[model samples]
Target: MAKTYKDVKIPEELFFNIKNFIEKYSELGFRSVSEFVNSSARNEMERIEDRKRNE
Candidate 1:
C-alpha cells in the first residue's frame, strides 16, 4: 500500500506524554514520536485483525 499522511487529533496531555517517551527513548531506537506512534498503531491494527480472523 502507498503511504499518505493523515492528520489526527489527540489530547494535548497524551501528545506531551508521547513526546516525552520519544525523547527519553531516542537512544533506544525511536527517531521521533511520530515513528513510535505509527509503529504502535500498525501493530494494534494487526492484533485486531488477527483476533477477528480467529473468531
Candidate 2:
C-alpha cells in the first residue's frame, strides 16, 4: 500500500524563518522546512511520552 500525506498550515513568517535557518545551517541535513518540522514534532512527541511514563 502507498502512504498518504496531509498538509499542516503554519504562519508565513515562521515558514520563512525556518527556511532561512535551514539555508544558513545546511549541515543539519534538513532538506526542506517540512522535514525539519516533522522531525521536531516527532522528537517532541517522544519527549512528552517519556515524561508521562516517568511521572
Candidate 3:
C-alpha cells in the first residue's frame, strides 16, 4: 500500500535545483522527485546503519 505526505515549502533556488535533478533522472525512468529522494535517503540511512552496527 502507498502512503501520503504533507507538502514542504522550500526556497525557489533549492526547489529549482531539485527540479533539475529530477528532470535529469526522469530520462532514466524515475517517476518523480519525491520518489527519487526517498530512495536516496533510504540508501544513505542504510549505509549509516551499517556503519553504526560495525562500530
Candidate 4:
C-alpha cells in the first residue's frame, strides 16, 4: 500500500538532528536526504519482515 503524504510540523531541534544525520549519511553517496532516509528505513523494515517470514 502506498502511504499518503501529510504536512507535519516538527520541532526545530528534531529537524536539526535529522539534518545532521542526513549530512553525515550524504557523504556515503546518498542523493537526497529524504530519499536516503526513506530508503534506509524501508530496507530495515523489509529485513524485519523477511526475518519474521523465515521464522
Please list the C-alpha lDDT of all candidates, in the order they appear: 0.87, 0.98, 0.78, 0.75
Candidate 2 is scored at a TM of 0.93
Q: Poorest 10 consecutive residues of model 4 by lDDT?
A: 29-38
| Alpha-carbon lDDT of model 4 | 0.75
TM-score ranking from best to worst? 2, 1, 3, 4
Weakest 10 consecutive residues, lDDT, candidate 3? 28-37
Worst 10 residues of 2 by lDDT: 1-10
Instruction: Pick the lDDT winner.
Output: 2
Query: Once superposed on the true structure, which residue ranges of model 3 sit more than 4 Å away at CA?
Result: 8-10
Write one digit per residue (lDDT tens) for candidate 1, span 1-55: 9989988888989988999988877776887767888899999999999999999
lDDT of 2 by residue, 1-55 (tens): 9989999999999999999999999999999999999999999999999999999
lDDT (tens digit, per residue) of candidate 3 on 11-53 = 8887678778888767866677667767777999999999999
The predictions' CA RMSDs to the true structure, in order, are 2.5, 0.7, 2.4, 4.0
- Candidate 1: lDDT over CA atoms? 0.87
lDDT of 2: 0.98
User: Candidate 3 lDDT (Cα, whole model)?
Assistant: 0.78
lDDT score at residue 48, model 4, on the 0-100 scale: 100
Candidate 4 local lDDT, 1-55, one digit each (tens): 9988755465878667777877886777765546665777799999999999999
